[model samples]
Target: MSSNLGKIDVEVEVKSPVDKFWNGIRDSINLFPKASPNEYKSIEVVEGDGKSVGSVLLIKYTEGFPLVTFSKEKIESIDEANKTLVYSVIDGETLKYYKSFKGTLTVIPKGNGSLVKWCCEFERANDEIPEPQIIKEFAVKNFKNLDAYLIGA
Candidate 1:
């Protein structure tokens, strides 16, 4: 990584099947707020059909979520065969501290469950800015919550 760039990878092992977990992530616009209403206020597609590359999603975080009020992310790529999705923060309060930010999510099959991996690549605007550990924690929490939701469903 570059001097100003940072990368973090977080993983969560869940009881939900790989297919189920991957499906939930792909349909996050509808299931995220339902699974964790306290964390996500809403997620709406502002561009594209919410299913393809270049789709832009506006994600609103609930009050007291300890992060930005909202985020605008653009879908860069999706590989269904590999069960991976890549998105970048194009416009959001996160940009205030990050020169650039991108995230990639992948789901892998495990014994009767799934292992979800989240990788965040970010460039800080200044050295004083902290690494995005909060975001990584949030991703781990979201995966666990989503896993519960998928298992229940």
Candidate 2:
């Protein structure tokens, strides 16, 4: 296998209107724990102005086999017109595994529903950490939860 470390991207199709999908993503801090109680324990705004740009959120995870630790991500931007959200890891256990981490979520209108795209760009601190794979899995699960929430599934 070729050893190339880079950004990871995952996309999910939601059976809901673009606006509805965007709203769910915009309020992800409050929605995630409710949608996927088994994966996420809780989420709180630790600093800044909530979901707006510059805000920071602390995400707590439920204990499980993988043993995911909590993380703190700072909101870099939220574009309503384009339906995009950007954030970066500021202070969290994630930094211990990665040199730098940033995530972007974009919602695109498709027919009656929407397509949600999640992207994570990071540099691993060492070969031990599974940067892209772990990030990809996390994003996929979150995207599925958001899709289910929007469709009342």
The Cα error of candidate 1 at residue 72, in Å, is 0.5
Clashes by residue pair, model 1: none
TM-scores, all models, native as reference: 0.97, 0.90
- What do the candidate models score in CA lDDT, each in turn? 0.93, 0.81
What candidate 2 gets wrong by more than 4 Å, as runs, is 1-5, 65-67
lDDT of each residue in 78-136, candidate 2, tens digit only: 89999999999987677777778898989999989888888888877777777557667
Worst 10 residues of 2 by lDDT: 1-10
Q: Could you give candidate 1's per-residue lDDT for residues 1-153 as a string of tens digits?
A: 668899999989999988989989999999999998889999999999887999999999999788599999999999999999999999989999999999999999999999999999999999999999889888999999999888888
Judging by TM-score against the true structure, name the best candidate: 1
TM-score of 1: 0.97
Look at candidate 1 and tell me the lDDT of residue 59: 96
